[model samples]
Target: MLEFDIWELYRMMLRSRLFENAVMKLWEEGKITGEMHLGTGEEAIVAGVVSQLIDGDAIAVTHRGTPQFIMRGIDPVLLLLEFFGHPKGLCKGQGGHMHLFSKEHLIAASGIVGSSGPAATGFALALSYKKQNNIAVAFFGEGAINQGMMLESMNLASVWNLPVLFVCCDNNWAVTTTTNKSIGGTLIDRAKGFGIEGCSVNGTDVEAVWELANEALSKIRNNGGPQFIHATCTHLEGHLLGDLLLRHNRDPVLMAETADSLKQYAGESLNEVLMLLRKIGGQTKKKGDPIVFIKKKLKDDADRLKLIEEEVTKQIDQVVNNALEISKGGMKND
Candidate 1:
């Protein structure tokens, strides 16, 4: 497995959570005018999967991909500006949250369905042609898996012996519908038909996803071919943020308990933030929030971790304020 610093993993996950929380606040305040989707409970999958990828690697992410962008080392200030439709965003405010691209980082995300799969195949083909010891990863939800192009791309990757990793972030729901109702057979099993190795894991468990992804990356790099990681994760909110009507399997009680757990994390005058988290958490039914889950894992050093979170929260707040000021002032990044 890829050896990684556990604390760094925790730090990145915490940062992703704080950033999402910031976006939620901005969206509620009518600053990020559009559909908002926060991957609060699903942060681990992105953290785990992306941590295993390095500089030369290429990645294509789906609509619920801001966390993936954060894990890829994109600056949150720029991303915030982009989310706010400011010219300073990663795509200069044109792409918003769904499309974050950085050629230097070899990363791209699309708001469209099943698009990343083919995009990844093309990247893998390039990497192979250049004889580079790099892999391309495509991340999509279970709903996208049903798309014909998605499966076709997997086949293309396998037939070409391309170094590609397909990560199906299966939260079991396609918007308001469950995956079992929409999909047939198993994701891992179906990959065998395409002559690619596949496995499923607990998406909330970041370490597990990292370990599996590391193994797949190693095999792809050393042996040359495609592989799959089917991650079964949880979504704490609707497919779209503030979409109560599309509520699928959320549990108000669990969310309330999650809210209670945040009291100690709240600082003076940050009660609004705490209240926001609590309100969102009350609607969630996931077994554990990614940030809270990792905090529990680091319980032995909870004091230090908590301090780190406080520091991160401060940084996020500062960056967000700066981004908003720049956006509101009509300052151009160009």
Candidate 2:
């Protein structure tokens, strides 16, 4: 039996989506600088995995890590302040969103593609040395599997019997190129070659991810050594916020500009680009929206759902407002 609270998972997913939406607004208004990578699409995978984590457990995530950090109980206000480069931010205005580090939470993230594997493995090594019954998790994209460091980390984790769960959030696209075109063979087979047990799951379903992650964590806790989870998710917002391809699909002017650029330099036709964009856009449909999927399942308790959404919205609004005030020097910092 799947023993978990659907409402709690729904609330977590909703809060992550709303929080990222607020961050998107900030980036749009030019308040938050730099290329922001919103985890707008991978909410289910993040919530499912992070919610199952206990204290003393560690995590290392990829560049699109806001969802995981927030779900892991980091203060959203501090995260926003960091994005704004405020001195009171998480890394004291130094790390921004990509290079977030929270020793208190035992979580660290890097913009580097495959660095999470090594970081999480190191955390697992430390846990082993200290004789703690906790584990470490590394979250990365399918593209990172090709990186030598990532493969080596997996091998090392297996060799030394480290309690680390390597999660491959395969979105089928590595930035712009299709991941299947680059990655050879199945990821599960790759893990098996390294003596690690694993499973694959549809990351869009929160309950599915939750159940599988719970089972994997249970095994790791029982000294099952290193485990792997190849969860396939959709990167609905392309690679980053204000993605050029998605922008072209939305704005006619950008579309024309892209067409002209392609014709002038690459000699590619606009028809080809449109066809590709259409295919990508089709994937971001009703079936892929994890938030709506879970919300539908919880429809029996509509009143409770409404209250949860309202609470999350109000909380996120206050967080954004306070973070903005602090960023604008209108409020005191902690």
Worst 10 residues of 1 by lDDT: 244-253
**Model 2 per-residue lDDT tens digits across residues 1-334:** 1357778888889999999999998899998999999887789999888998889999999999999999999999999999988889999888999999999999999999999999999999999999999999999999899999999999999999999999999888888778757988999999999999999999989899998999999999999999999998887777899887777776678777777777755535556677667767765666878887888888898999999999999999999988877777743455
lDDT tens digits by residue: candidate 1, 223-242: 65999999887777667887
lDDT score for residue 72 of model 2: 91
Checking candidate 1 for backbone clashes, the offending pairs are 255-281, 255-282
**Which candidate number has the best TM-score?**
2
Cα deviation in Å at residue 296, candidate 1? 1.7
Residue 155, candidate 2: C-alpha displacement in angstroms? 0.2
Cα RMSD of all models vs. native, in order, equals 8.7, 2.2
The window of 10 residues in a row where model 2 has the poorest summed lDDT is: 264-273
What does the lDDT come to for candidate 2? Answer: 0.89
